[model samples]
Target chain A: MHSSESSEVEVKDVKNAGMPRRELLRYFFAPKAIAVIGASATPGKIGYQILYNLKRRFKGDLFPVNPKQEEILELKCYPSIVDIPEEVDLAVISIPAKFVPEQVRLCGEKGVKAVIVIASGFGETGEEGKKLEEEMLRYALYYNLRIIGPNCHGIYNPRTGVDTPFIPERRMAKPEPGNLVLVSQSGAFLGALGDWVSQERIGVSNLIGIGNKVDVDETDLIDWFKDEEETGIIALYLESVKRGKEFIRVCRETSKKKPIIIFKAGRTESGARAATSHTGSIAGVDAIYDAAFKQSGVIRAESLEHMFDVIRAFQRQPLPKGDRVAIVSNGGGFGVVCADAIELNGLKVARFTEETYEYLRNRFPPHYGITNPIDLTGDGDKDDFKDAMEAVLKDENVDAVILGIIWQGVVLEDEVVEVLAKVVKKYDKPVLGSSPGGEFSSMMSEKFNRLGIPHYPIPERAIKALSAMVSYVRRREEFFRDEE
Target chain B: MSRILTEYEASKLLSEYRIPMIGGSLVNSVEEVARTASAIGYPVVMKVMSPDILHKSDAGCVKVGISDEKEAERAYEELLENARRYKADAKIQGILIQKMAEKGTETIIGVVKDEQFGHVLMFGLGGIFVEVLRDVSFRVTPINRRDALEMINEVKASKILYGARGRSASDVNSIVETLLKLSELVEEHPEIVELDINPFVVYEEGKGGIGLDALIRIE
Candidate 1:
């Protein structure tokens, strides 16, 4: 709701820094004119693939830079960025590393808004590559040119059709536009993750692969995304943070308005060594990062899978009002598992109010256990599920609900998906689902996903996701209290 | 890389930060030690004052519960003898005679300079529990009273400090005050590489606690 005010303040911050911040990012993601340097005619070349991907839906002026080819892909080709007639906003440089410095110099000479250097063999190599990258950074700073990556896959803003990741559409999956923005340090990792996201139909607003963040780091992008109206949540996959103190401060401010989830790599000695070699980042003591995250109220995900799970939950559900969770499952064993997970995550298994207990008892049969985990026996049907869920949701003490549908019951069918979704929306409280099976469960989960209900394959994971939602609300309240 | 400060020097530093310390005096001779003990009252404690001795109790340089002047004199001699036997090349400055602090729950408050995040403050239940259980919580320095309060409650043994099992609660506010004051001191003095107040005696509520021993190291 306060996004507009925060965005205005961000615009002023960008203006004070001597760069129109909003326009600069817009140029990279939704530029009116783009110059693709090193444009190639060969179908298999990196430059050719980038141009092909942009031609799909980039509703802007596209200029191909190729000295040899006069006309490539039906667009006039220029030798360099300076040859372009119209004022170029962004330059996608995908040439050899040796020729990148001069191209960047020309980009600065032409007053380009931002440059995404998609070349490799810098910094990640050895001392020589490090020196070369240092020289490249010098040129970018001297000309006031903001850079995204020198060895990264670049950005993919599906909302604007700005696909600069050098991968063709045929080889990649493109999901629809949604509100989650993913910022990753590893370009290749984002490549594979993007394909998975596409297959799972997980919509994203922005996908940035920040490789060798010399001129622009994660904090700079975080500051920009904090006020973005389209961004509902910000998720990061980082090996190291460049500016520690500023990162904490910005996150502390942003997390108050939008939840920030991070999947920090290099948590172990061996993992740290691998990260240093991969990204050339000096991953500091893991404990210090832990303390910093706690101080800033940034939710931490244990792994990539866990990050996706939590992000889906945050994207699908509203922030849980409290830590008290009510578990309603058809399988008694699953309820036991959810109970263990809820307590393990420091969440209480809410004791249903006397009225809620009485209501639940009438909804289900006398044989069904009507306690906190109101176990609706194996014979429970869609009506039993809806009645029990609605009863518990009305209880003042119950904050959230986790419904486990085994799907193997004789009376249960796919209709339960809509029943659960309607009740969740009516109450405006978070409700996570668990359906663990093979083909039927997977198919039913997609149906649940469409209804904006995050369904986990197991009871423990569903409870963990619900617990994360609960913690985000609690942490934000703590921050709000501090502000007061 | 770090040099330990003497007991008297550490106490003066703590006083500068307004962290209360048990009243003590550094006396040079046996007669002076006895006189100081008698002046402070009976059942006093004596320790060998030397920079070379980091762990005074382990080196047998610490002697507590002396009832009279004669016992204080003997403790001084025994401390000197133990200091010599442990490390003959060590420099023995004198003896520090302090009033015996009343028995209370022991706790530890310390700070370790982290390479990435700067100074981090640590608090936990003191004595053997600190070593065995390792129950502690850390926060970046320059913490306010609220942060200090959270740090105290973050430790599991905090229940013990909150009057567990019908015992009177310890003066938790005093520990919070000490934490805040230490944070200010560490921020003011960049050279303070590490500081430890092990066994910070926390008395009953309404009666503030005192630091019986303090160690400050400088780069």
Candidate 2:
């Protein structure tokens, strides 16, 4: 048994070795060939899913290991990794909880560099299961073996044809990957989010769910994400942290180089207790978490909906100038509500500069709150919403704009959205909207998304998106946006 | 002197420094409890002044609003009997007869010495809010005037002190000055690990704040 003193020394050595950016990211995103241990001919099992998904999503070689079945998905199967007669980059284990230890030991002896154990009921179960997990970790640590998760849903990457198969429809994006990497602790939520991304047709470089991390955790993943050339943003959804101080330290260092957005769930007492039961984490005082988030340049996501909305906006829109917002509305109350929500979030409601007003004076009725949220006086046409947005985006003083369309009582929904989308695509500025108008809202939302802008249901949510952009721009100015 | 300071004796320590506190006097025996209650004026309070007792109400050592000398004497006897029964070996430091102080807006101020940074002072809403709401703020001791103002503003319910609910505003500067003085007191006495002045009622603009009840613990 290795002493903890030597373990600390090994950690220090790894810390100082200056691992290359591409190599670390490759460990997560682009492993060359993978072997599926416990691969089954039986459909709907985890092992079958692993083998089938790898065949469907990846171009790399996939070897399925099953003792009884000579073949799976028409590919020849080896009973164990040692019998493969070739070098393997990764071994993914999906055997039953009782057989995981032996499979991992066999993989280690095969000299595979990395492993992803897609088995549950390890540490998350009672004491007996925990003892087994400790043994697995001891094996990994002593042999310098890297493990993703003993209880995770596994990872997804488009660049290396290494899709983990949870996302439906292989072509989620145009296959043009960008610099956004998602690291979540909830496999259930991660699965749902991956579906959302596919449906929304958003491109992601890497999406990982590190459940109950007995080995690699958020900080470890973040340290790798910071150095990766293709990753510009790191989105995190954590139920709790393994080390709050260490996590904050890494985030503070990394967020200075790339935008870091985090969503936490254990704020309330009962919620905190439930989180502990699920993750075996002691969620300490909420204030400390608050201080930690603020100290690190982490944008706090209020809800799952906001998580997707904020990341999508950051990816497409230009950095907002400041918090100053302009609201264009077809109703007085919609304009009023959006104004209050915008001010409440610490963003200034932009007063139109003289040049912007002089340009738009002949464009609409004088009753509009043109200094603010330009109210189009209820009878304004689709051309008015378009013209007002164009003027606002071009003003150069306004950081972002939130437009409110009240509905059929005012103008045709399609016509207004068409005009708005044209202006948004032209300006290349951050523009958000909120409409409570039935099916019309959905149509408008689709167009807003099509134009590469974000739209929501309520005024408050739009303001929150704008606030995130303002923070991102400021962090970027500090040249500490996201550091490796 | 007793091992634990009586209400009057403790008041003397605060008094010597001109710390604003409710006026009261000490009386040694039951007969003196009646005489002191008469001279201090009727409708006063009689409390067991045992040096060993910190929370007089819990010990059943408090009798409030005594109307006359007879009532004061009887109430003082009841208090002595209860304290003796509860803490039998305790030294009876006599009764304290004080005029019933007028009620006003309540607040709590305290100083607790922390291991990392020496004494830290706290200010916030008192009573149930301190436990359930935790509406309080803290800062390391020896604070300047600006730091004192910041501490007061840090609490969520500080709007009440700044005149919420259509009420008259308390003299905020006086409260800030008192906090500065507290920071100084804690600095001068490192042995005082815990000191609390609960329900420190302050009157309208002219009347200033008063330390109605004080509990100080020292190493």
Candidate 3:
């Protein structure tokens, strides 16, 4: 929706300063060329990892600059940015604390436009680091340079193959750039999900491991990514927002334009404490953030993994037209849990029509519950599953269906994927999963994806995603319409 | 302390801060109104001054655009009768008649201090629709010229100030200047709790705005 570059724009002394900056962000999706200053040959360093990711992921031009090395990762390393041959659009700086100021200065002199500072010990550290960051920011501002972080991890644009490292977890890294852009304030929370999303074949568009954002914050990123054509869904894991008013405004404004899923870590005191310790982010006033979210219509994820779960579903399935959800479960308890999660998320579990009910009763047991949570008594086969799912899908009142497959016996992934895929594609309604059995969880999710059904790992995620989809429609109608 | 300061007390504090106020007398009766009317000018407006009464117009205590002694006496008697009828216990301190302030366009300017965020000044088209439309902008106060302009620009009625839909442009520059000056005054004197200048008649083209009605609550 919006571009990363646009978020770091200088609200110049000129009144029209912000508009041009917005235009600049559009180039971030597929950066034509990049300049890497402070490109170190050191093994564990962020620069090395960043270079590795970019060269491997991005198919665009890459320029490496290191005063100490002649070559880095087989790419020619220039002494300074002033020597880079190609006119670079973006610069990634991962150097020692002392040298960052000079590198920033040199970046401006070379006319390299945007810079991401993957260095620590800035304003977050104390007065000295704060002064250093302020000086660097002053230089960036004077040069019209857009800066991402002074103390932060980096950003990843999967579509562009532009990966800059400010994130910590090194060995467990798996680069998968799908259509979903997950912007997180906590690096560890985001860094953990990397392997899972890729292994599951879930598409991710952008992953920003932002830490102590000095120049560019979440507001900037939301503004940049909100309107991105490549990004189908946006998922965020934030403990605190630097600009409360702007965050609410952007989320309210963007949620209408596209589906934005959020995982806020600060609901309870303990969770908020963990979030702060993990990311140097305060849980903020939970009530205020909650109110802000409610006002703006952002879908709040229950946990970090749950955030990804809902996102995975949104990425796979087309949004259900309305809030009416139909639940199909093998067990009564699972059906009830699904119902609770649905209503808790502010959506109603839609009832099946009499025709659809008869369609189900003919195929399943007479004692089966069939109002909203169509429970096929504990002992039900694949035929019972298919019939119940079809009955729910056929109902005009049910916009979407949640399949709570227990998989009591041995479940074949290939077989289920084919059947579920057919039903999902035929009806054009989103179908989700809540298979309590451990043996079938992975297989259920796998099939869910193959058939274009957005399945959640938990009932909560399914409810959250459905609620977000409905909110996206509502927001678009309320704020993002043709008229102001 | 939420102190209710009289008009005189407010003018005294504002005088030190260079806030301009209209010259008038606080009259007790029809005789005093006649005397004040003669001294002030032929045409004068008498409004009831009471701490309990915030909305004088609604209370029928605001007698605007008055002319001569007989009219002034009748307006004062009518206002006093209405004020006593409404609140029953509200003391009619006196009638404040400065002059019939030259009416023009209407604009509102005020500041609200939030517990967590601090003082944020607001500027918009004044009156009943203010809360409804919320055509306003805010900035952490003790504002400079840039902030003042931004605050004024925060409202959609800003286009109306620029003379939208064939309406003549109001004195927007003056509106911003008054808000900035007002913000600085209130920020400096924390003793002044709430200050309002509703429908601050933005005078004729190029003539600058005037505070048509001024109310002050002090601490």
Using TM-score as the measure, which candidate wins?
A: 1
Instruction: Give the clashing pairs for model 1.
Output: none
TM-score of every candidate = 0.87, 0.69, 0.65
Best by lDDT: 1
Candidate 1, residues A30-117, lDDT tens digits: the string is: 7888889998999999999889888876888899998898988999999778888898888999998878888888887787878899
Error of 2 at A323 (Å): 1.4
lDDT (C-alpha) at residue A69 in model 2: 88
- Tens-digit lDDT string for candidate 2 (B30-87): 7677767777888897777765887788889888878987788788778888989889
What lDDT tens digits, residue by residue, belong to model 3 across residues A292-347? 56546677776766676667667877777888899887678888898898888878
Q: Compose the digit string of candidate 3's lDDT tens values, residues B1-219.
A: 465555545555555655555647888867777888989997887888887777778888888778888999998889888989879999667888878777677776654433332334556676543656645555545555655765567567777777778878887778777777777786777565455555567755587776666666654
User: What are the clash counts of all predictions, listed in order?
Assistant: 0, 11, 15
The per-prediction CA RMSD against the true structure, in angstroms, equals 5.5, 8.7, 12.5
Q: Give Cα distance to truth, residue A410, candidate 3, Å.
A: 7.8
Local error of candidate 3 at residue A335 (angstroms): 2.9
In terms of docking quality, model 3 is incorrect
DockQ of each: 0.21, 0.05, 0.03
Docking class of 2: incorrect
